[model samples]
Target: MRVGRALPLAAAGVVALALALTGCTGTGSHADAPSPTQTAWTEAPTDSPAPTPGATAFVSSGTAAQNQPVFDAAIRKVLAKNAEADGNAVVAALKAAGFPMNATQVSQSTTSANLKPGSIMVGVKVGDSCLVGQWGAAVDGYQSTVAPVLGSGGCLIGGIPVVG
Candidate 1:
């Protein structure tokens, strides 16, 4: 009788294990979730303004010296839509727009160990040039300022280190 009971229990355990393993496969409901590459654009407001027509010129050579205005404008557009977004969100937006993830950095300064409501900078290095964007409470408003990397490291103002 014990052997019979053990056989049934073992069969049930095997069945349960098979079902659990099936669920572990990536084909479940979570598979429908937007990937990191798609999340940024999907989360951005539908009415967000389009990048200037000339913005494409900036990425052509991937060098800041080629067309600073277009590059700056493009960065400004991305940051404006994500002014209130966190560092990860900003980096996601940049990556979704074709900026290399390895070349991008997000930094913020805080007084204590806790993150403070301070400035947020997103910098992307392309070739020898860098594009920097800044936005935060310290700034005038939700608008983000974008410019070519300066001597002080245009976008990297605080040396707070890259969080993402």
Candidate 2:
């Protein structure tokens, strides 16, 4: 049942990405947006970076597609860490950027062996979709995308989702 729902949401994401890309002319290196796998997050203005830029204020009443860019920007804010970035850091950064804690799910920063996991995932449930991100040495860096929520109506299958 959940898979059934995911297909359409995934299609919508493709459509949105297509539309977003269609308008770009790539005037130069800066004109070309970062590829999904693009790395290098840096130079935050403050300890807690600001929300999405004024031009792209979050669409509180919009679809997951509408919220994705804002969410990605927020994630980038947190990614400014020079070192020691973890799932908990992403959670706090998202929260500081105005994403509610209750709507976010995150993987444990460390494994049962008390070692950092290969990667960490953070997700914010938006409407029927999720804005998901993962980062670490294993992943070679950070990546963000829109995906459907799981059958359990959450993002990560094993993510720690705070309720209340």
Best by lDDT: 2
TM-score, prediction 2: 0.62
Off by over 4 Å in 2: 1-57
Model 1 ranges with Cα > 4 A deviation: 1-60, 65-82, 109-111, 142-164
Model 2, 19: alpha-carbon shift in Å? 39
lDDT of 2 by residue, 1-164 (tens): 99999999999999999988977855467646765753444342243333444424545455555566677666666777533587776776677656767889999999999999988888888777788988888888888887888999898989999653
The residue-by-residue lDDT of candidate 1 on 64-164, one tens digit each, is 44434554555566667765666666565565566666656667534467776676676766555576666677875444333456576434655433433
- The lowest-lDDT stretch of 10 consecutive residues in candidate 1 is 40-49
| lDDT, residue 159, model 1 | 40
lDDT of each: 0.58, 0.74
* Count: clashes, candidate 2: 0
Q: Which model scores highest in TM-score?
A: 2
